[model samples]
Target: MGPAGEVLWDVALPASPSRLPGATMAGFADRGRTPAGLRLIPPPAVTLALVFGPGTVVLSGAAGRGSVVAGLGFGTTRVRQAADFSCVQVRLPPAVAGAVLGVRPAELGGAFVALDDLWGRDAARLAERLSETSSWDERFALTDAVLARRAEAGPAADPEVAWAWRRLVRTRGLVRVERLASEVGWSRKRLWSRFQAQIGLPPKRAARLVRFDHAVHRLVAGQEAAFVAADAGYADQSHLHRDVRAFTGITPATVAGEPFLTVDDVAWPSSR
Candidate 1:
């Protein structure tokens, strides 16, 4: 472990099933040793990770260029190609995460696709350079450049969708979709379409993710089940358990007393 405690969220990629022709698969693992505490990572995910000890080079799988390191938040999705066989992972802030996906953190409930949709060849080259960097500062600078470009190239999010997002954040998972639509002067159908376009997922799904995110935060911070359930807007403790399992595939007890470390948890800090 680094400055933090033991690597709490270590998960290896599972083997792919045979019989699929030339199947390409990807997964991510987070080490809990970094100085950053619990993170709120969201979905429609994008990440490529490799672990290198302190003062080592980090590189992607291919020999590309123009790589950058970015910190993203929950509810942003992008395609990530891993660099370096092993390297320290970093946490992402919501803004950067939104920039990468060409959407805001408030809009992330769709499936992940290729980076080409957003970055084209530049993304591939960046992956290569990310794998080759020696200094973390250089990596971070490159990441900043990438984020800047993404911010420039990415489309502006819908004002109404953003408005709904602000309300969701404020409620801490207690707001309703009808209220959101009325506040934004949109029909439910119109709101869903606009929200999906800007944020990848529909409002209901986003709300669920947000609610689950809050529950995880409560667990990580060691709140009692009763309080966590109520504060997170669950119907009750059992409701919280059901939702937690749906997203994380684990029980609240499994994560209790430990800082929550799911991708969703890492992307949505406010929920935490």
Candidate 2:
């Protein structure tokens, strides 16, 4: 799933039978001997990474290392491992971040925090349990059960904000924020404030992030930049390039070759 001469990391998407609301997907990646580091570009959903690894998960410029809860990255986030690693990564829409993690999306805003900070003893217990598991399937089941239990103990998002977030996702980030406010029967100001508080990004920025995500997948699919720009509602190729570079710190051509984006079709099939 990588370019020529690139080490192919093994990635598996394990199905979550629980159908937990607001949870997008969960995956297992065991990058054995792949020296390549990872840059997690801006995506529409928050990310939770739990490591039961052969190596430590280190974030750029951070003093400590551990499993993390990352908000919708407003910009590029770098992750590196010194050696082979095994971990379960979960994608949670903003609506579920609070319920499943007991924190608002805004709390994680634009940064990655050690899961131990948020989950305390529970985080350590889960890591120990996951490390003891013999297979990925067993780890996934345990992880899903933990999320379900936490969700029940935490607060859910405001119904209106939740609805608006779903609409943005369903539309692939192409819908207008004003229109969304109207549809939700909230004034534009109210919608803007609440969305920022709960979802961690303003409605317009969220839309742009989601749109950028869509364009990234298209580029990875081998679509021409001009066509992807036009189809994704960008003003032109330059605008699309600007957004891609802003989110990923690289040009469209480079992003197209990124193993992370290229492998997403298999790792996140339905999302692609």
Which structure among the candidates has the greatest lDDT? 2
* Local accuracy of candidate 1 as per-residue lDDT tens digits, 1-272: 12244543343222322121111112223342323223223422233232333222222222232223332122222223322233323333232346545655444323333344445676666656765876555554555555556656666666787678657756865788998999999998899888766655577876787677667766866688888898777889999888766665568876554333533243233223
Query: Model 1: runs farther than 4 Å from truth?
Result: 1-5, 8-99, 102-109, 112-120, 257-272
Task: Specify the highest-TM-score model's number.
Answer: 2
Per-residue C-alpha lDDT of model 2 across residues 1-272, encoded as one tens digit per residue: 55673556666666654457756555555555544467667668888888775567687754366688788854776666545567788888898888898999898867888898888988888988988998877888888889888888888889999999999989988999999999999999999999999999899988999999999999988899999999999999999999998889999999988766776777677677
Clashes of each: 35, 0
RMSD after CA superposition, every candidate: 10.9, 1.7
Global lDDT scores for all candidate models: 0.50, 0.81
Q: How close is candidate 2 to the true structure, as a TM-score?
A: 0.94
